[model samples]
Target: MEKPRTIPSVFTPQWLPLGSLVLLLVTLALALTGCAAEKKWQYLPATRGEERSIYVIAHGWHAGIALPAEELGDELGFVREYLRPGRYYEFGWGEAEFYQADKITPAIFLKAVFWKNPSVMHVFSMPAEPAQQFPGADMVELKLSATGVKHLKDSLRTSFKLDAAHRPHPLKGGAHGEYRFFTAQGYYLITHTCNTWTAKVLASGGVPMDTVFTLRSGGVMRQAKDARKEYLKLRPDRAEQEGMQ
Candidate 1:
C-alpha cells in the first residue's frame, strides 16, 4: 500500500491572518483615541458688567427677622397673627434684611424692609408665628443698601469675617453662630443667628448670610433661565473631581 500523504501544519501560514488581526486592533485603538480627545465646553469667568447684573438681580428684597411676637405687634400695628409660634418662627420682609444685624438679644423683635426705590414702596415687617412666645421682645433692624451688599461680597472674597460659608462657632449663652443669603421673587434676604443648627441649614440651602448683603448685591427684577450659570462656571473643575471621587 502507498504511504499516506502528510498534511501541512495549521501554523505554517499564520502571518497573513495575524497581520489582519493586528491591523484591526490598531484601527480600533485609533478610533477610540479620537473619541477620547473630543472637545468639551469651557467655562468662562463672569465679566465686571455680568457680575454687576448678577448682583443686581440677586439683591432684591427678600428679608426676614426674628423678633419677640409682642414687640412685632407694637412696632408693625398688625402682627403676623396667622403664624404658629414654634412651628414657624422664621420671617421674610424686604431686601434690606439681607445684611445688617446690630446685636443678638433673646426676645428681640426683627424688622425687615425692602425697596426698589425706598420712597416708592411700603416697608414690611416680619410676620409672627402662633407657637412663638415673645413676652418682652426688643426691636432689631436688619438694613441692606446697594453699597453694603457689594462691600459684603468683597469681604467674603477677601476676609472670612462675614461667616457666609456657614462656619460653626460657639457663643457665650449656649448658642451657635451661623449666617445665610437667600433670594425669592425679585428679592434677596440675609439672616444671622447664634443658632448653629439653623445656620447650617441656611448655608446648605444657598440662602444669603445677611439681608443687607442681598439688597446691596443687586438682582434681576425677573428670574432668568441662565441665572445659575455663573455659579456653575465658578466651579467647573469640581464636576471632574467629583466624578473621580
Candidate 2:
C-alpha cells in the first residue's frame, strides 16, 4: 500500500489548529459587530420656495417629521382634532421611558435598549411667527408632490395605534403646550429604533432614504441632506438658489 500521506507541517503543528480556530471566531465576531458609522446632523443645501413642503428635523439625539398639520390632518383624521389652528406640526416617535420619564436612570436606558418598550408619538404644533428654533435641531426640506404628501400622511396614520373609532389613541393628561403624546403602533428595540422608524416613514412618503444604514438621527439627516441637494439641482432658480445658501 502506498505510504499514508502526511498532513502539511503547518496544519499539523499543535498550536496551529487552535490558533486557526481562534482566528476564525475573532473574525466572525468582528464581522457581526461591524455596523454603520455614526455621524452628526447637518443642514441640507436647498431652498424653501416650494408651494408646500415638509421637513425632517434632527433633534439632539432624535428625529421628527415636520409638516403642514392642516394637510396631514386632512389625510389622517386623528390628527385633525390636534391640528389646533396651526399650519405645521412636528411628530416624533421614541421609547416610552425616554419620552415619558421625568428623570433618566440606568434602568430606563437598559429597558429602552433591550426590552420591548412601548413607544410614543409626540406631536408638537408649529405656528408661523419667530420660527421656533429647537436648539441643535437640523432641518431638511423634502421635495414632495401632492401624491407624496398623501403617502406620507398614510404612513403617519399607520404609526399610531387607532381606537375603535379609528382615531389615534390620545394619552390622557398628555398635552403639554402645543405638544402631546399618543399611543404608537410599534415597540421600540435596538434594531427598530426611533431613527429607523423615521427612515421608514420618510421612505413611505417617496423620499429616498437608506433605512438599513439609518440607525441614528445623523444617518437620517445625512440622507435627507443628499435628497435636498438633488432636489435643488433639478429645480434651480434665482429665489431657489438664494435659499440654497
TM-score of 1: 0.17
- State the local distance difference test value for candidate 2: 0.64
lDDT of 2 by residue, 1-245 (tens): 22222222211122333455446533543343322233222233244443357888876557788886557655565665754555577777888766766555556655666588889887766654113434334778776766667777888888888878787777632333455678998898777778888887887766767665466677788778877666556567634755878
Model 1 lDDT per residue over 1-245, tens place: 21221211110112334455546533543343211112221222333222211121111112122333333322222223322232222332222221323332221112221123100111122233321222222222222223332443332222111145433221111011112222222332122211111222222223233211112211111111122333334546633554588
Model 2 TM-score? 0.72
Candidate with best lDDT: 2
Candidates in order, TM-scores: namely: 0.17, 0.72
Per-model root-mean-square deviation over C-alphas: 30.1, 17.8
Backbone collision count in every prediction? 49, 0
After superposition of all CA atoms, the RMSD between model 1 and the true structure is 30.1
The worst-scoring run of ten residues by lDDT in candidate 1 lies at 117-126
Each model's C-alpha lDDT? 0.25, 0.64
